[model samples]
Target: MKAFAQVFACLFCIALAGVSVAQDAASSTLTDAEQAFVDQMTESVLVGQFSVDGRSDRAPKPERYSIQSVTKTSDDNWIVQARITYGKYDLPVPVPVQVIWAGDTPVLQVTDLKIPLMGEGFTARVMFYKDRYAGSWYHGKVGGHMWGSIERQSPDEGSKTPESESSESDE
Candidate 1:
């Protein structure tokens, strides 16, 4: 697992570098709606709760993801800069995702992406519409459903400390 983590970290860094280059050469081909989606996601936070499968008796756990920015590189490619803080690790991750629209809604698609400190085999279909978000996630043997509201983050709130950050993306 440690070796896998190291390799994943290296790959993630390389992907981020490519994303940066792609962002620079990106054309202004985004539709009005896509631009709006990017604007809305800038400095936003998805504050909501998540449920663990087979744990119906337990209350849904709170989760918040702070998105510093979202940039479209191509027709369906986007990079979301998200600050992930777990335990003593706090790092800004440039998550490259594919965005498919459901009418005017944007759904972020991630498949088997390995994130540093978040483990491998992570798959999620998180959608954003209006000011709400809902998604299904699968990480290894644990899977869950998440839904929440999108809120603008204040300048002072760079990042909120999680109640209990988990290694899972559910955090």
Candidate 2:
């Protein structure tokens, strides 16, 4: 009886260990290098003095762009789920785009997009995918809604805090 119990306990522990490792890998935070890529692309999109720069103004300006969730769907890709509110109405729009690293720059390309660019009572679904290249990885100017795209990143990302945190305090 003691032997059997010991075996069962060992197996149970091993299973739990496996599960924990998987969760970590699945929800793995973006590496330092990856975050840098996201930052650069975002900077590129910021238009200064209506300069017609990358595409910030033309990108529909989703009200809130803080990434809500991220899941690793593959080795080279991540499924980035974000809730975007557009315009004064601040309507709830969920957009999931794919992000990957190309060379030193992290490329935020669109795997799929959905938007209604038509008349009232109109609905649109965009399965648009952007194939961009730049330096080492992506070319550039890949997928997006309205106009442009950048790999979204939360501010105060690199700190000694937990992963499931906003890194912001009530101000």
Q: Which numbered prediction scores highest in lDDT against the true structure?
A: 1
lDDT of 1 by residue, 7-33 (tens): 332222222212335544653766888
Query: TM-score, each model?
Result: 0.79, 0.32
Residue 36, candidate 1: alpha-carbon lDDT: 80
Q: Model 2, 82: alpha-carbon shift in Å? A: 2.4
Query: lDDT by residue for model 2 over 82-130, one digit each (tens)?
Result: 3222222222223333455454544444322333321111111212123
lDDT of each: 0.65, 0.29
When summed lDDT is taken over every stretch of 10 residues in candidate 2, the lowest stretch is 43-52
Clashing residue pairs in all predictions, respectively, total: 0, 10
Whose TM-score is greatest here?
A: 1
